[model samples]
Target: MKEVLLVGFGAVGALCTLTSKSLSRSGIARVTAVARSNYGIVRGKYSLCLTTRRSRVCNTVASAADQAYDYVVVTTKAVPELRLTPEILSPLLSPEYTNKFAQPTYLLLQNGLNVEKDLYNAIRKLNQGKPSIVCAALYVGTNLAAPNVVVTNDLVNHFSQRESLFLGIYRHEDHTTSANSADETALLQDLGSIFQRGGSAITIVPEIQRVKFAKNFWNLSFATFATLTGYTVPSLFRSPPASKDEQCNPYLYPITAELVQQHSIPAIKTTMKELLNRDPDNSHVPSMLLDARRSQPMEVEVIVGEVHIDMLYALLLVKQNQILGRMMAQ
Candidate 1:
């Protein structure tokens, strides 16, 4: 059986695991997952059952004696509070077990722009040597409906609308190829086929960073706005300015629009278009937004700050351009 290990079993992790299980049961790959804390129930339906053949290890490391896995999916949240450094993964990253599960193909299913850079630095400090790494951009919108259970939209509807997950392998600077190098075509094709078999929609691109940056823009915008204001999705989406609230206060709508359009929207859009060549029409509410609405600490620094830095450098490249005047005029 082809073996796989998943790290960080949150919302995306749950979806990834379920999809893996379906594929494995169909003889695609054997799967196991490692979680920091074993919440007896995930999402809402599946109970954490140790009796199953597929293992779920907690507070343990897979040494070299254990067979190397085919894939390692890292789904840890990219926020500072939830970040997983190589030192944090030292127990499982030790060299003593290199012969075992150390050489598995790795995939980081996280959000943010510099995750690969951070992971590389962390691993270089902790790992014996580099392992193959792939990057995944999980596009499906899902939430925990119950312990061990996740509620996702129907696969058919999701794919039909092109809301399926967008996945891509990574290309480090050391790789001797252009930004659009076709290194992982076969791997992406395999992954895409696997996801499709599991009833998911998928598009595997060569440059995952572009898509990653694009997603970061939407993430930062929603997270920054929703966090500062204590409002949930239903409330914000329903309570538009032109709605009932405007009768008593005409200023509220324009104020909100100006805040969004002037500060958050422009900053995000400018960064995304300049850096990743992304269009503003395709938008998404990032996980940070969900966390903020629920009164959770924000991931603003990692997601938004990185983009701002990149945008500054981008601005430098076009500092003398005529178009700058037209863009800033708005």
Candidate 2:
């Protein structure tokens, strides 16, 4: 059976676990997930069946590395300021693991542009071979309410929209070519098939980085707006404030919304076009905003660093300084 290792078990990671479990049945694959602190909850979520073919969910990367994995799906956020991607993937990049097993294909399921370079370089150095990387732009509306609870915003009746997942094989050297080996292509297709079996809109595209650039463009666009305004992107779309709380305080309402459309929206687009381009579903909050609200380290480097929009980057840095300032005060 093919072996799959799923890293991270938070909001996005939990959803991926469901898909990984689906891939496990039918003698197709066996999954070993590194769930970290959520081990008990994640382990309890799955059934053992008292059989040998049951999947495994462990606490650490070392334990999950007991066997070789054919595919490594990392669903963690790209918070390079706190931890680099290569460091987060230390066990998988270790010479001990690379020397023992065939290099596993990596599937990175997160936002931001050019987040795969560090991991790609690390794997290339260790294996001395061409790396098989699958880059995707995933759009799902799920939030981690607490540690293990993930809430989605899939409304029905005239306002129903399924998630969008665009998968493509990535080569650091070339972006347009999918001339990867037949086996790699089959694996990528199979992965898309498995992810799509649950009704998500999954598309296999040839130009993935360009697609990622497009997705990241929207993310950074709204994210910068949120940081600058101290209001979520959904607020701009609420149309005179819909929520009970928002209805009470409607300052950042339609006029602010106009400013969003006229200024924030167009300026970011022009900046990206000059640079080379790239949120809806209003209930969803941008990840950077969420991180900022929690006083945690935001994903500045991966999301805003590449584009070099100095104004936006400075705003985010100021926000990060505020987070640090709060900690220092405490």
Candidate 3:
């Protein structure tokens, strides 16, 4: 069985832990969980209920890594305080005496566009290389219901019980490998088994940047608007549309007024189409929006800022094609 080491015991970490338990039950993998809040390892056969399992809790990274792991999954938030730096993660990658672990795979289950890039640079800066890198875009949601317990939102209650949760590797200009590669194919198959065990669906795709950007379009637009307006997703939809007098009021910022006027919403919609080749109708509550409502620091720069540049580029391309009469009329 593959030995898995999970970092960050937050929402995503909790989900991964549960998934690990399912995997362990199937005899496909064994997992040890490490978190800043605590170092707790829970081991059980597949039949164990995640909520009932007691984690072998600890508080330090060094203490958690008494032995090496065959696969290391990092699920911490992108913020530096909770993030695992290369220095902290390096020892787990170490090949030393009494450590049976060899080059272990690294799976990053973080959000935003630069998750892999930041980790890659960090690993490179430390002169560490060996384990294959895999980037994943998690389309599941989890809530920290208790101090050590993470609650998984029933997807059926959220996404109309959609069978497949999208997972893929975000490809940049320099990285040319497709998700169809041997590593990804095998990983996808393994993930498929895990998802199936959880009664969920899995779709593995390459060109993850396109999906990431598409996801960002939904995450940022709602997040920026909601943060500025202090409205929840459901509440925003319930807000009455501004009348002309309210739209033209000089007291309101013109840009803000325009957004409220709904004139720019179509442009935002078009931007989503241009970036992801699809509209935003399928999107659920964006993480940033959730964070904003909870009074947490939002990833404005990472999610919105990074994708905003790309959105503008796409906008420019759209405009240019229209001027040249080369537009793809929808």
Candidate 4:
């Protein structure tokens, strides 16, 4: 049987664990999870539950080194504060264990662009046999409701209404022009089948980068604004007043009025339209806003820093164009 190790027990990780358990039930795979804390609690009483549903207990491992894993699914947050490499790899890739354990397939289920590069580099540095590295851009909405329980939103509608996960092998070249080799194609297909067997709706694509960027368009636009303004995703899309009197009413909540006014609505629409011009279907509550609400450090650099830099460059170019226009008029 295939042995799978899942790192992190957050919302995504918990969902993955449920999938792994389904695989285990089918006798195709056995699963274990590695959580940073609450080892005793998880080992004895760990359970994965949906919101308002019964809890199902899960298997927990204190350390990843306890057993050799065939696959490692990383579902941790893609924040720099977490020394991910050392924390994840040291137990499995240390000098003593590296030779004893076979190189495992590493599946990254994190957000942000180019999220797999650093971990991939770390694996290559091991100088062992190259392991298969797969990246997934997931669109499922889930939250950890308790230490051992994960609450998923609209799971029933996911299969019929929404695509859940997009899978692809990591490629440095532009995916639009790049084709996967026969071996890579086989690997991706196999992984996709495994996930499908576990009841996950997965689509294997040639270019996961495009999917990541498309998803990030919504993230960088709405998430950044929401983080700064303390607005929820649903709140941002509230219907505006149809009349000027209603729009200018001072009795309305200050922040709500500001957001729903014609002046602010146009700016919001322009920003969203600019970002989503390439992919209009992209929409989700920004994970960064959730982080801000939880008082966790947001992924400011990866999610918004690049966009902010591009905006600065555009301003500079506009300024230069204005100066050139004045010179021409003179």
Candidate 5:
């Protein structure tokens, strides 16, 4: 059986754990989860009701790495500025684990640009074989909720009975790119098989980076603006157009049109398009906005700081500096 280590078991991780459970039942995979309550720093709680599961759950990454895991699926937020991903997984990358067991494939479920770089570099430095890294772009809304519980906000599609997942093997290039190696190709298929067995709608893409960059635009624009202005995605679509009266105006801030038209629109056109597509009533709070309000660290370094465009680079850097700088002071 494929031994899997889950680094985080929040909403996204729980949704994925269901699949891990399926893989376990089929004897395709076995899972060990690091299930602490966001290391006691986070306050959001999961809200899912599930049958009592029997998988091994540990309180920390060091304990969870007891066995040589075949796959380490990280669903934690990519906040390298606070704590680098490699630093978090140092125990797994340590000589003790590397010498004892086979190198594990990394399945990164975290959002942001080039989120796999740190872990990738760590494995590369080991000079073992090629690093097997799987990156996913998911279309699911989740909240950081109670321990061991997931707030299942209608993530599963009743029509298909599966959640959408876009998968790709990562290849980091400074200035050039190359084809996936034979081994990497096979590994990608193997991961696809694991998720497929769990009834996930998986689409293996050739250039996952492009898809990731496209997704980042939404964060750079909608997520950033919502975070800056303290509003939710749904506020952009309030009734009868935003007006002077605060009641009719949907935004927490009065400058609804000014926010959308002037800044967020240019950065990305995704938020309004999504609103036009699936009209949902649940609180569509941007994750970044929640982080800011809670006085927690945000993913500005990856989502904002990693933009390739020089034009946006300076702007994002300034914005992230202001946000993180304030946090540091506090």
Candidate 6:
């Protein structure tokens, strides 16, 4: 049985535990979670509730010292300010514990473009052994209902909406290639199977970089607007005002799809033309807006800001190339 260790016991992490447990029933995998703060609450008994209203207690661990795991899944948020190396991975990948645990496969289930690069580099710097890195772009809608309880939406609906877990190997040398090794391919297939058995739809893709870029494109277009305007997706789709008083009210005047198409769509389309695009059926509350509402720092730098920076750099490069072309012609 493959021993799995899950870091970040939030909504995604808990949902993974439930799926991993289902895999355990088939004698394929055994799952354990590393609880950083909620160790006490998670260790004894914690429940996961599905959209169907089914609930079950999940398994968790305080640490990974006792056993070696074959896989480590990270479901943490990808924020620029957070140093995950020391805060999360050090305990497992440190020099002293390197020998104790096997060089496990690292599955990063975080959003944003190039989110896996830093963590992958940090793990490589360990020099213990090369751990196979799998980058997963998750589309699962989940939330923590309580300290020890996680609730997830229906998998059927999630899949119907074309929301799936996209997985691929992380290789810095080439972002366009598929899994280079047979082992990596097998592992990915196995993971896909496990997730499928657990009821989550998953796809192993070749062009993960493009996939990340596409995901970020949507995020940047919708999330940035929602974050800046403090409006949800549904709010953005709210009907326009009929009367002058309604027109004057800020709350009534939503930045609707018509507005976006008229004013923002052209720029958005131009900006994301190269990436070529990649949603949910739920009430369209962007995560950034949720973070802002909760007074938590949004992932502005990693998600929206990074895209802006890349676009600026691309424009600069294009301008430089044009100048050189003109000079050569002259």
Ranking by TM-score: 2, 5, 4, 6, 1, 3
Q: What tens-digit string does per-residue lDDT give for candidate 1 at 53-95?
A: 3544443334312556677677767655444545444555666
Q: Which residue segments of model 2 deviate by more than 4 Å?
A: 19-27, 44-53, 155-163, 175-184, 238-281, 324-330
Pitting candidate 2 against candidate 6, the one with the higher TM-score is 2
By lDDT rank, best first, the candidates go: 2, 5, 4, 6, 1, 3
TM-score-best of 1 and 4: 4
- Of the candidates shown, which would achieve the greatest lDDT relative to the real structure? 2
Please, what is the whole-model Cα lDDT of each candidate in the order they appear? 0.55, 0.72, 0.55, 0.63, 0.69, 0.62
lDDT at position 303, candidate 2: 80
**So what's the TM-score on candidate 2?**
0.77
- lDDT (tens digit, per residue) of candidate 3 on 1-330: 556677777777766566543433444556566666543333332225532443343355566677655567777766442334465576664555125544555677766677666556644444445335666655565666555555664433343323324566434344666547676677666755654564445566775666565556655555555555555445454344577555533576878977767977688666645543322232345555565445454455456556666654354334333433422332
Give the candidate number with the greatest TM-score: 2
Model 1: lDDT to the true structure: 0.55
What C-alpha root-mean-square deviation, in Å, does candidate 5 show against the real structure?
A: 7.4
Please give, for residues 1-330, the per-residue lDDT of candidate 4 as tens digits.
677777777777766655442333334556676666544455565443221122222333334576687777787777654455445556676766777877788888887777677777677778985657888877776766567666565532423334678888876544564567888888887767667777777888776777777667656666666666677555555456787667544586877777688588788767555444323222344566666566555665556554565763353334334444555676
Query: Taking the tens digit of each residue's C-alpha lDDT, what string does model 2 give over 58-94?
Result: 8888777767787888888887766777897788777
Q: Each candidate's TM vs. the true structure?
A: 0.66, 0.77, 0.65, 0.72, 0.75, 0.71
Measured on C-alpha atoms, candidate 6 has an lDDT of: 0.62
Predicted candidate 6 versus true structure: per-residue lDDT over 157-199, tens digit per residue: 5233354688888877784465447877787888777677666
- Model 3 spans > 4 angstroms off: 19-26, 38-58, 81-88, 93-100, 125-131, 148-164, 169-179, 238-296, 309-330
Weakest lDDT window of 10 consecutive positions for candidate 4? 49-58
C-alpha RMSD of each candidate structure in angstroms: 11.2, 6.9, 11.8, 11.8, 7.4, 11.6
As for TM-score, the candidate ahead, 3 or 4, is 4
